[model samples]
Target: MMTRYIAFLRAVNVGGRQVKMELLRALFEQAGFKQVKTYIQSGNVIFDAKGQEAALEAKIEQLLQQNLGFAVPVCIRSIAAVQAVLDNNPFPGVIPDKDFQIYIAFLQTLPGKEATAIIATLQSDIETYHLNGKEVYVLMKKNTGAPPFSNTYLEKKLKLVATTRNLATVQKVLSF
Candidate 1:
């Protein structure tokens, strides 16, 4: 049976690097995936495949490197798993558009003690982090782009591959 999966890709369309989302969907289809659909333009792809998770991830990564001409980190999560990540958000009570916004950065696994300790050190600066399984929930204040809250810093501190999107973007992606 084919299972639904979401591939969150890093560094797809950013920093003036233009990669069309349609091209991304086509790459997945060429890689033998079905029902391929891309959400927004931040490289959120949903499709169905049949195989072990590790093999699937390797296949997709290889396909990306060959087709996109660059190494793009891919995080594959089941549709159900993505839904659970959205549902289990710990900062629901906070105003969504006010001083609170959540971003779920998918990871391969929980960070080790050293990496996680480094990430914990930066938790007190206007950002709340909740590490749930292979996902990190970030609740940032009104201005996300300012101050110490950013995806680049968090990824560096945690030493893990990650891609982040606002809660609204996340919900839109899940709806597909």
Candidate 2:
């Protein structure tokens, strides 16, 4: 049976780069996905495909590169897995309207604390982070553009590949 998977694409419609969501849907369709839907402009897609994680990731990445003329990282997870990630967020009940934000940073493989200690040390007043398995939950209570205390710092500090999506987008994806 086909399983529902979530693909989080990096650098799709941000930083002066623009790719229409309809185009993204079509690309997935062209690659033989059914029930294709996108959550937000940041390249969150849900589709049903018959395959394993590694194979599906490669297939989607190749299709995206061929259609978009560049490389974009794709993180894939099963629907139930994604639901558990959201349900398992330990930092809920944080202020909802403040500068607070929660992001799920998907790792290609779970990293040891020794590998992430450097990033851990760089955090300051603007950040608080928690690691739950393959997901990193971050709470940022500073200005919106204040260097995104959670994301950029983690990637730089860890030296391992990762991608992030806000809690709002994550919920939207889960609702699909």
Candidate 3:
């Protein structure tokens, strides 16, 4: 069966790298994806493809490097997977409104034990995180301004490529 997938791309449209979403969408289509749709410009591509998520990840990364002239690490999750992420959020009562932004950072791989311990050491009142497999749920209180547990911090401490999206954005992607 065909699956609706969200390709959460990392290192796109950030740190001086410019990638046009329209061009990225065209690459996905040229790579054999259907029902192509893009969310924002942060490299969120929702497309329909048939294959294992791992294969799709590799395929898209290759296509991006070849066509876009940069390596974009992609983490693919199905619609059901995204729904499960919402259902599995560890911070139950924290509503993702203007006051708070609940984000899920998709990791390149499951963090190792050492990395998990390091992440645990980063516990703070402003930011809270829970790691489940390759996904990390981060709750950021808007009162804190910029979050300490940013994608850069997570990638640096965990030594993995990570792409984050707010719960609100995930909900919007599900609507597509």
Q: What's each prediction's TM-score?
A: 0.91, 0.88, 0.91
* Candidate 2 or 1, higher TM-score: 1
Give one digit per residue, the lDDT tens place, for model 1 in 1-176: 99999888887788775789889888899888999999988889999999866678788889988887888888888889889988998887875776667777787556776765665676766777888778888887766567735778778778887777777887888898
lDDT order, best first, reads: 3, 1, 2
lDDT of each: 0.81, 0.80, 0.85
Residue 114 lDDT, candidate 3, scale 0-100: 83
Ranking by TM-score: 3, 1, 2
Q: Extract clashing residue pairs from model 2.
A: none
lDDT of 3 by residue, 1-176 (tens): 78999999997889888998899888889888999999888888999989998899999988888887878899999989888988888988888776777889998676788866876877778788888888988888786666345788888888888888888887888786
- Count of clashing residue pairs in every prediction: 0, 0, 0
**Model 1 lDDT, residue 130, Cα:** 84
Give the lowest summed-lDDT range of ten residues in model 1. Answer: 142-151
User: Model 1: clashing residue pairs?
Assistant: none
How does candidate 2 fare on TM-score? 0.88
What TM-score number comes out for model 1?
0.91
Q: Candidate 3's error at 11, in angstroms?
A: 2.5
Worst 10 residues of 3 by lDDT: 141-150
